[model samples]
Target: MTEKKDSPSFEETLSELDAIVSEMENGDLPLEVALGKFERGVALSRLGQQSLEQAEQKVKILVNEQGENQLHTLPENEQP
Candidate 1:
């Protein structure tokens, strides 16, 4: 799991992952360092996937009403 103390946003994580991948491709980092970067990249990818899934779930699927497709508003969640 990634550390929460300096948690990065989805975009930032993706950018970092891209950099790590590019670096790994260059074959400059040692085997151990490359492996570590690979692990971090995997974790970042999972986090990005999760964020996308959550956003998708929030979207309301369009419905056909009276032969016209209409988009519904997002449901309001109960506040704590």
Candidate 2:
């Protein structure tokens, strides 16, 4: 069987996006280079959004396990 390649975790994606933003913000890259980085940033942003949406859906499911619509807020210490 061929091994499956895993995508980067949400945190890793955000970290890479942050690095790209910092590099672009330095204002030293040529136009072509900046455009390439911008395109990558846009793709990473979309991936981050999808990750967030998936996490939100999971939270909703766990919170409403019994079919109740109420969402109980977890304690600050319990937050990841």
Candidate 3:
């Protein structure tokens, strides 16, 4: 049994998902094992999606200020 870890890194989750895909594609695993892998893959996919959404929310672009570019923070509800 694999021990569950708290808050696995995005890369780790992605790698696990890829491995699950490969295993399923091979078509040699027992139904129980395959179903378990599929379930874990779904969980990892959800976590990855959430991580991406959070990153998108926090994304920012830096502009050079030498000429006239200015930095500003927008309200969360006003983000474009």
Best by lDDT: 2
lDDT, candidate 1, 1-80, per-residue tens: 34476778878988998998899999989899989999999999998898777665445332343454555556578433
What's the ranking of the predictions by lDDT, best on top?
2, 3, 1
Looking at model 2, residue 45 earns an lDDT score of 95
Q: Please report, in order, the local distance difference test score of every candidate based on alpha carbons.
A: 0.77, 0.88, 0.81
**How much does each candidate deviate from the true structure in C-alpha RMSD?**
10.7, 4.6, 9.4
Q: Name model 2 segments beyond 4 Å from true.
A: 1-4, 72-80
Looking at model 1, residue 32 earns an lDDT score of: 96
Candidate 2 vs 3: which has more lDDT:
2
**lDDT (tens digit, per residue) of candidate 3 on 1-80:** 24357889889989989999999999999999999999999999999998887665444222342443555789999999
The residue pairs that clash in candidate 2, if any, are none
Candidate 1 global CA lDDT score: 0.77
Those runs of model 3 whose alpha carbons end farther than 4 Å from true positions after fitting are 1-5, 60-80
Using TM-score as the measure, which candidate wins? 2
Which residue pairs in candidate 1 have backbone atoms (N, alpha carbon, C) closer than 3 angstroms, thus clashing? none
TM-score for each model = 0.65, 0.78, 0.67
